[model samples]
Target: MADTLLTAELDETHTAPTFAELGVREEIVRALGEIGIERTFAIQELTLPLALAGEDLIGQARTGMGKTFGFGVPLLHRIATADTGTTPLDGTPRALIIVPTRELCIQVTQDLDNASKYLKNHQGQLRVLSIYGGRPYESQIAALRSGVDVVVGTPGRLMDLADQGHLILGKVGVLVLDEADEMLDLGFLPDIERILGMVPTQRQTMLFSATMPGPIITLARTFLSRPTHIRAEEPHDSAIHDRTEQFVYRAHALDKSELVARILQADTRGATMIFTRTKRTAQKVADDLAERGFSVGAVHGDLGQIAREKALTKFRKGGIDVLVATDVAARGIDIDDVTHVINYQCPEDEKTYVHRIGRTGRAGRAGVAITLIDWDELNRWAGIDKALGLGIAEPVETYSRSPHLYAELGIPEGVTGTVRKAKVERDEDAVVVERPARAPRKRNRRRTRAGEALDQTEINSTDGGAVATSSDSAAPVDNAGTDDADENGDKPARRRRRRRKPAGEGDAAADNSAAVNGAADDNAEVRVTADNGGHDAETADQPARRRRRRRKPAGENGAENGNGVAAEAAATTTAATASV
Candidate 1:
């Protein structure tokens, strides 16, 4: 719990004094005056006196309330004062400012740099360096080796450099944790504790946040020593600025883009910011606005660090009139001229809604916030509305062409969704031609027989026939003769073939033939007479085979000689000789 609470009522009569009147250093006051930031915001005015006295405090305020400079100005002032015994003017980092995101780190670094521009030490000028991830580590290491007066960095990168012994936190006289609630939301509590342990406990510790959760308060109770809690507004009911006019409407999901396009054309509009729940939705809304001829840019988690920085830079410089972004990626984006904020998609809770709409209506300027809630998002929106005490529980059903919408937003009559002329490359009245279907390919097969290729004329077939033949074919049947004339003018003759029988009875016939024909044998290159009447001498040189038959087993012939087998063999041999 905070030991002391200071409620600074911020209302229409904001008669705050300038930084010079608050006893700020001449250099810082002059530097701020050059940037046209002379007057102190509520948070700054309340926090400056306590913070400059080297007292620990917690700053609780709405987003875009100039909280960065609240702790930043005091931090620079203490580090720049050479007479301070604890914080001597040296290159060693006398002050450390920790933020949650890289964008916030850069923003805080710029703010402190501007305030400390003319303040100096023996090393020449008061140096402020930004150390965040997504940039090369070598440069940051080199910068640390060279020494810096004040350091602004995120938790992860700060811990990395500290662990590597490249950063010196022992000499730090002041430690500030900016956006402490966002760090808790991002699960950086452990790293934050580690950083708190590293810095000197005797130094000044200041914690700032837009909202304080249970864990954040617990962290403060554990680390901060009797800190003072300062709230710019009264309580939960005053979360949003009084100058910001909020409108909620129940709209169809499909008509959201169309409705937003019309809202961009509303009168007295300047740069606008459209908030979405997802990176994809942010990109979609940005693209939709771009196609409608609106100068738009986008920043989300999906984009690289450089791209996000570039979009924010363009938005600040007036290069883009509209910016679409998701909740997490849009933190620390401060632009003074933002006039309108559209909720392309309903935020998750009251904090997100406040943060989104807080981008506009900054620096005590009047602004407008319009929310289009789909039917499914009504319950979620109701919870936010109830939490923030925004009594518009049942938003009116509206569309792109609703008369009330036009009147409420101050849209001119006869205005359409698109502002740019669409280009039509193809003629609308051109004839529609149909292309023909593709044809199938043909197949050609090459036929081969006996290691020789056969031409189409050499192969002739009859459908469902027992035999097929051609006049010039080398293929011939064993039992059939061809009537076609040959090149030598000879007629083909029929040749007969017989199969050989088993070995038992065929051995006798084979022996008898071998004995009778002498050297003439099976498949021998010997001349053979044709069984037909025709005699073709050229065919006689080819080999021919003579078939044989098998011999049967003799009955009881096994008892040869001593057992009647010899007598049966003798009788058979005599019968064969007589038959031959």
Candidate 2:
């Protein structure tokens, strides 16, 4: 019936049913058996029957409770032509499974492939194509064109391909939404509804989630057509992991890495995972551990899809013993062999805490989970602790060197912090690229004077007579007509009164040159006459031209009278030259 909640669950005392016993097809059952998956988990045992009958049901189970196979097996079984006598395979998709994250899409695809290895149709083995973002569209488009019987992809990529008319959902008979609550948490509800609208309304729908909140329940009601709600949890089963041993320590933020390092070196430690609240912190912790000589890989939003997949692959294949991941990147990561889970930083809430620690203690394995709570994060962690009913409201104040930490995680006494720190130089995390330093710059300078270049000899030598060689016998400077004399033995400043033109071969230029020489001769003669005429101190200091100009007007002032003849002779010559 559509409105029924099947509360029947397989208790621990009761033996679980095998895939063959639950009427799974022989090919699928044999394929699963090859991988040592003979008996079904509680969720699979409950879901296989209803899912095989092509009924819409909501499967609920905690994380890592074999939920992928619970729906994957039935989806493959019903899609095979021999099992249900459905239409023969074509290139079109027959069953569509939508997951929330790229990692989960890959995980679900791998599981379906493992189970459907032997199950085939008239064409060949079932084609399960994985499509997700951060991948080229060409490859996925080509896969769809070649032929895929079942498609497992995230909501975004699936819608993109559907919109572009590459992935054909019209023929999809069975529809599944794996990790339904995670989809809601990631704000994929609208996209999920759109995907639901794209698929045929008469298709078999199954929704599986770890925790059912109001939104997920409402979603189930709106689209699931009163589907059967099958919860695979035991009666009175507490939400906490029964097999996982949790230890919460009030640790300083700065020293948490040291504490984690010690815990990682514990004797009982196997493959470990560390979770952080931010992408940056995940990469930091990963690098920190790597420098300590541990093979650590990091997965986060900042990493490219190739790098993320590489880290996950390496973690699963034993190539790396530790993986540091953020909440978003670590979603849908189902590794059963993770022996220890370390919360490198605080999680957001109880829901995140459950999903984070659930990464370990999976597939019925006992796991150890340790949480380091910072002083600032105590309030946040208290809320999570209260929500989960963990009695450790105030975490024990502990440090990396605390004896209790060594005792609990089984760290050997006196174990060094560095398990292999001597090799840090060659480790991948110790590299520091040195940037090249810039060269010094050379400056060009100029020393300038306004008009003419002053030579050293010109600055030192002047037209005045030189002093005697002996200091006591030095003659006094007898400068008569200096414009501005320097008592400090500096030369007087002098400037020419008239500008002279360039000399040419014309008789007029010759005449002008003769006139300039005659005036210089007149000034020199006047200086001599004035010096001899009981030299008037003020008049002698005056320029020789002023004296010559005054005495030239005095028709017969002694020197003027003498130089007047030479001036008259030059005047006659100049007049004759002009005529020529």
Candidate 3:
């Protein structure tokens, strides 16, 4: 019977049967029974037999189809048989399944676990585990220590754990890459290569993706050996596209969030999922909606696994009226009754656009997919429109107050824009004005001694010669005022005055005693010589030498006493003897 169904599926001879008539092994058939999935979809019917025969196969199908089970059942069956023959080293599994997201990891692991339930060998010999990011690694490490028969995880987390020696993949015989295109889209090809290198070189490899782009084709060629390509027709968007009316509105970047808030207030918005281009924008939109009295939740890569699960649960259970999310959540959401899908920001391309709106209008329900575009996103939207043949060269320019928006979404006219209301009117309550910030104060300090002296010198030198006084003027005045007559004013002849000593000439009396005595004896001769040039030259030379010696001590004794002639004479005599 299995051969008949397989041949009929390959040749189109007869219509395929229910999963019950597919002649799958009793264990798998019973596992599907528990999930209430009694029949096989066309893609599953075409690929399961080939996969179970250990033949390499390629499956082309849309998202949300049962492709996971098509390849999953055979992998689980192979794992159970391989486990019975040889105990894996340190409890490593014989099978490995790599997915693209944490949510898919959880979903696929649950499916594989269900499929492995009925297999024998009994008494706690088999184990299965799923690992992904946004969760602590303690539990995953503990699971690996105990051993898992099948490992399901995203490429990044799987490679991270494997590289850290927390996971072992040396004995894996069955390797499944699910949603291979998405993995490439997310730039995880290098990580995938590292993971594949760890598995046994010769193994049964199966690759499943929705649309096989050129890169995926190259990947399949490199990984599989003469694989049979099973091309399943893209699953018709039976319930989604048929029920959702798509619209694109061009607005300003700053006003996109306002448009979304208006859409949330629309009467038809049962529970809306607002898609954004980045995780930060998702959080911002969610927060804005919450501030407007709407119950909103958010989910993105930055959220912890528990928080992500909680937000998803709230969105599905009507606890949140609006859910702000990014493309990562777009593909993983499988809820049935989301009434509106709003693109708060334009998507990267049409593939993403389709996936974003695909969240709603599911299960034969009519819904709406509304796109709010900013001026900057127009070029991006054009590229997407051409790619999907949307033919919408320009989107309609819209504002928060557009009448058509109010008519279509059933929002009132006056309630479209954002505004913060005052708590009370000025007449009803007193208003307190806020003080402005104060400027920094400037500090004043006293000047140092050196700075004050520099200032005074600058003041004195500003007029040049007017402030230039000779430093020796005071000495000349004191010498000119000295007493030359006694109190009686008599004409008595003056005693001979001693001349001052020159520098290095210790005593005045010793240096000039002969000249003084000769002058007194030949007073007439001295007078006649002074009248001519003989004694005048001598007198001029003596004062010039005295000035040179006095210059050094003049500044040093600016405040010294002048009435100590007797003591000075004694000191001079003592200095003359000491020098000799």
Q: What TM-score goes with each of the models?
A: 0.71, 0.72, 0.63
Compose the digit string of candidate 3's lDDT tens values, residues 249-304.
98888777677778877777787888998989888888887787678899887788
RMSD of each: 15.2, 17.1, 19.7
List ranges where model 3 is wrong by over 4 Å. Answer: 1-16, 81-91, 114-121, 234-243, 265-268, 361-367, 406-580
Q: Please give the clash total of every predicted structure, in order.
A: 11, 0, 0
Residue range 473-534, candidate 2, lDDT tens digits: 43343433223334443443332233344557464454456545445443233222222112
Q: Rank the candidates by TM-score, best first.
A: 2, 1, 3
Model 1 error, position 384 (Å): 0.4
TM-score quality measure for candidate 2: 0.72
Q: Work out how many backbone clashes candidate 1 has.
A: 11
State the RMSD for candidate 2.
17.1
> Which stretches of model 1 miss by more than 4 angstroms?
11-14, 83-87, 421-580
lDDT of each: 0.78, 0.78, 0.68
The total of clashing pairs for model 3 equals 0
User: Order of candidates by lDDT, top first?
Assistant: 1, 2, 3
